[model samples]
Target: MLDWLRVVRMADMEAVRWALVGMSLDTVERAPVGVRAAQLWVSRMLQVGLIDRARPAFRQGSVVWPKDTTSGRVPDLFRQTARHDLAVSAVSARYLARGYEWRRDRRPITRRDHQADGVAILGGQAELVEVELTPKTPIRYKAIHSNHGERLTREGYTRVVYLATPGACRLAMKEADRWLFRDVRPRVVAAPVMDARGAWSGEPDAPWAENLMPPAPPDDAGTPALWEGIA
Candidate 1:
């Protein structure tokens, strides 16, 4: 079951934003139940560190490029990127709490091609992260990601993370990383959070598999004696 679910994956960014977009659409359509459900799902994912708010640009860096350095559509691209970044940020924060040090929103090596979402460099760890908004088929997608895993490997980033929506090309990207860098993370996460409706409408039949609830507490007499001496 774990293997099966692993195959049915979602990037944290796309999962969170997809919920947001669905809720937004429901709200715009005046679907009250859908709106409430969407809100709940979004809230749940956020609370669990599956999604986070994007950081503001320019902690204090100078405006290195002209205002219009990128095409007009660039802002839109940034918006898309930011959504994914938020989810990745949430994941990074969780890892940080667990003693992993990471830097978010890293500046690009070049000002001309700076990315709004930015990459994360795990402290003293050979890992590089890049979040993707568009499907992998786009030319920009290729330009940004092509040989990235190999380059990162050469540069000592042992693993590269490519978070994106589910698609054939996206899957291929993961495979490509295997052939090129030999250090990419094995799994491309699919983080599809259930909407409120989706959550309520379904049965909790697979509780242990999902780890949705804590294991039942021990009896008042204390835990079973089966392992008492072992402890």
Candidate 2:
């Protein structure tokens, strides 16, 4: 009955957990384990009845999930957009690269809040990561910023990080400016541009400067160290 459990490798288990939060085949393929290996693991999981796939409303590819997990009254991974799928994958890759472990809880911080796209833990720090692919209305963004800013601090998170495309980053920054008093302004980093192998195509040691607040000082001598330590 549990034969699928036996064939499951660490990577397979990780993939299933990620599916609980919704992931695309492309995202699963980008795991630290090489693409071919990840593909094999996902296929095996499907065969064993540990996971299922569904075509999201507007996406070209299907999203995956565990057989039947629920968050509140809703299915855990339902109707995600293509942009959301890519964002989740991109954020996951960055955290995985930084040696952070994915958290398993799928619940929201409070009944009034929504689940973050994903959470990563390293040492004593927990980071709530969000991928903003599209801009939310100004009112909606403010509500989100206010809710998360308060809850995250109260929950003892080290910081929140938002990995976003260039356009979305600008919108987030504008909202952040309004909520600066809440101190929930997340460290914003440009989502890494990756190739098919999941390897980043840009300069490895380049500082993450997109949407950086209080912009870096003009002179090299005075510029605050700008890298977010993500390598």
Candidate 3:
């Protein structure tokens, strides 16, 4: 099943498994047809004891694998809200469309010491995509901006795009203005939060309303390619 889905690594498989938890078949069907076939693959996984499903109060049921199946730590399906899941789905869909490989980098950036949601790599460059459903306190935002502004170049990211709710995007843009005085290099662009259905309603040419500067030129070296090694 993993090979059929082109899930090359255990980590990527785990990511797909976690993202599918509490997500409906309709939502999964939004993925490109080849990937959307997860509907049937998931059923087979359940039969083979590769995954499990649990019903939670006040929410849809969730699919999860046994602790021993991958990471020993328990999955946090209970703590995840619908908005959070939608954000993940939205980003996943975007990366999937672009044919960028996904990595679940739960670790903090070495230079900034801030944990990004995940990293997507196409070829040479890596993009850090941050999904913000709710705005953080001013102090927290300041810290994030300060760290990212200082370390983006040193950390080797091509750019950092913040996908957040309209209100949160406004706050992020306001904070980005402060970077002008500091002379941050890596571009920061803010796009609207994806809908619950994981679709973007914004214009295709310019999805971002707030950008510290013009969007960076495409990384020609970072052209889309087949998925490769897993971290």
Candidate 4:
């Protein structure tokens, strides 16, 4: 839990629960104790000062941080990016449950000027994962994709992935389909969170492919691929 918190840094109580749920993902029984246990353990940790939460915890989008492990300026980004970052954590939680080796540095800046959300490695393929809760300008997309494209050419990455929410998902896919470069095209899929303090709605339904993009995996678990020749 500390490792996930340190990597993700500042997540709300519910997002933390989702991460715990991912760790509790069982191939045999699929125990949901992660949800139940999250509250208990977190409260206990607060009492013992192993962790901390936004005061009066019932406030809208109350978040928590690893006070024991945190340093520098305290969680200032919590207010601005809580919704987006928690949504990203939801996506990461799903990946964790699916057995992907997903990770990012505590600072989360993959490149000097370009920071993707996280990267997933599985089956010897490295996927640069981006969570798009809102759309960016087209020109911004052009520049970002250009940089991401360069990564495909030189970096060890196999492909890029845009895990967008409902509205943003379609735009991400449209942009990918319109991309001229097939080698660097990204796989855009739906990854919606169920409102504030809610769970990820698109859990366990993976690699949602359209028109010959490989069938969706069974409900148990599945891996999302990086962009191939899927243009």
State the lDDT of candidate 2 residue by residue for 154-178, as single tens digits: 7666555555544555666667668
TM-scores across all candidates? 0.37, 0.57, 0.63, 0.70
Question: Which one is best on lDDT?
Answer: 4
lDDT of 1 by residue, 1-231 (tens): 112112212223323323233223233211123445544654564566443333245111111111222342212224434344344443333333233334444456763343323333334543444444444544544445444544453555433444333342344354454453222323212222222111111122333213211111211122322112221
* Model 4 whole-model lDDT (C-alpha atoms): 0.57
Task: Return the TM-score for candidate 4, rounded to 2 decimals.
Answer: 0.70
Candidate 3 has a TM-score of 0.63
lDDT of 4 by residue, 1-231 (tens): 777776776666556655666666466122234555777878887888767777433334456777754453466543657567666776665565455666882342455346788876666666677877677776666666666666666766655666665556555655655652654453333333334433355434334423212223222122334333234
What's the lDDT of the predicted structure labeled candidate 2? 0.48
Model 3, global lDDT: 0.51
Computed on alpha carbons, the lDDT of every model, listed in order, comes to 0.34, 0.48, 0.51, 0.57
**RMSD, candidate 1, Å:** 16.7
lDDT of 3 at 24: 31
Clashes of each: 5, 0, 0, 0
Misplaced by over 4 Å in model 3 are 1-31, 34-36, 55-67, 70-74, 80-86, 109-112, 180-186, 195-215, 218-231
Ranking by lDDT: 4, 3, 2, 1
Ranking by TM-score: 4, 3, 2, 1
RMSD of each: 16.7, 9.0, 9.3, 6.2
